[model samples]
Target: MKTLFLLLLVILFISGNKPGLSQDNNLQKNLGADNKVKIQSIIFNDIETGIVNNDVKKFSQYLSAQTYLSLINGVNGYYSSNQAYYILEDFFNTFKVVSFKIKETKTAESVSYGKGDYYFEKKGKREVAHLYVTLNKAGSKWYIAQISIN
Candidate 1:
């Protein structure tokens, strides 16, 4: 009887420790979230660098198979990766980027977006507009799904 009682106590103790495991799980989840934010920051920073340098090729690798572009040049729709390259190339050729500063980035579920101030010179006139970039995660990696410069 004592052996059975001890076994029961051990079982209860093991079960009671499960809550502690959940705390560890929660800690892991928090760490994972932090890691995700850091990764996004890095990715967005790279994109910002690409814009600042007026080189879409620097960020072309991040484009998804189909990227949506909403631009001031009356271009709005989904485009293939190759198409996006030339499209962005033309855009950069037209409006020379003076400076680009990403304001904030936010993520929800598997999608992350960053809004920035895009300052450029068009026809010798300096102008500014909001640049919004969206990224969607596929598996363990994120890809650029949309870029809107308006």
Candidate 2:
């Protein structure tokens, strides 16, 4: 009887440990999912407002330190956060944004991609372009890592 009781106690202890381990893994997965949702919301808000106002300062808030931009003609360039802000400033001066709208957004892990339609008034002529933007999460903030216009 004594030996049987000891074996039963050991089995109970081992069984209890497995559930605790599984719970911890579940918690981690939930936290990761929550972070991805938050990052997506921040990126959408930043881009939507930035384009409408032509505000580089607001736009740069979503950019990482090592952001790269590609233009419509297959031109590629990399910029630091500050440099990217300056480029946006130049864009604001050159073209007036009449309207902007986000067409779609997709998220994966720590990256998000967005496509949007933009209407611009350049030299009193209306032009439309589709913009593609990619964002990556850095710590607790999401930043724009790449942008392409075509």
Candidate 3:
């Protein structure tokens, strides 16, 4: 009986030492992920508003240090945030936004993509184009890493 008691005690000690996944830890991690998704959604909403209103000022704050843009006007490549701002400003000035709407969005752990419709008029010629933007999370903030209007 003494030996059996020692064996049981040892078994309990070993099992208790195991770091099996805890429900609280899992819940915390899930909440963190939910917060990130919420942030992505909010940022995308701001970006959509900016595009719809033809006002980069609405979302320019989210531009990454170096942003990649492929504009219909033939400006393509990575550019500084300041340069990207002016480039987008120029595009908006020339195209003239009739409407902009985000049709779909996908979010991952560290990146998110938004695809939408851009209806614009150039010198009274109205057309619609596909708009795609990528957002990358750095630290606790999301930044616009890429924008393509095709």
Candidate 4:
């Protein structure tokens, strides 16, 4: 009897009949299968390049007509695209940008968000800020819908 029970246990183990282990393995496989590639737009590169080069006009061209902007000085509101450009210009003048790079990006349907670091030189000292930009796709083009710096 003991030998028969042991053989049955070996068979179950080799056949992947371990309840929790098989369930966990299936879960992991499902998760891995669900992780699909995300599609991003070329405008994202243009925005980041404009920031790195400190070109206000180039950056502002990506902003939508009604863009929401949140500044570090507690200013948070929606502004027209032209107004947003001026705000960005002011920030570029106040803090000299040394480097800007996108850290991560996520897209859902028609909108994408990119988070990154914005390095600037302030008063002879280097400063770092978290930059998050949201781009919305309209028809066939993507435009900047929101920008937040913290």
Best by lDDT: 3
Full candidate order by lDDT, most accurate first: 3, 1, 4, 2
Residues 36-124, model 3: lDDT tens digits:
53766767887888888888987788889999999899999999889999999899999999998888999999999999999999999
lDDT of 3 at 76: 92
As for lDDT, the candidate ahead, 2 or 4, is 4
Query: Against the true structure, whose TM-score is highest?
Result: 3
Taken over the whole model, the C-alpha lDDT of each candidate is 0.84, 0.74, 0.85, 0.77
Q: Of the candidates numbered 1 and 3, which has the greater lDDT value?
A: 3
What TM-score do all the candidates reach, one by one? 0.74, 0.69, 0.75, 0.69
Stretches of candidate 4 exceeding 4 Å from the true structure = 1-40
1-150 in candidate 2: lDDT tens per residue? 999999999999888776653323433444563455354655576678878988866566667788887754454799888887787677756767899888898988888899988788778998887889998877755678998766
- Cα lDDT over the full model 3: 0.85
lDDT-superior candidate, 1 or 2: 1
Q: Global lDDT for candidate 2?
A: 0.74
Off by over 4 Å in 2: 1-37, 72-75
Q: After superposition, how far is residue 83 of candidate 4 from its true place, in Å?
A: 0.3
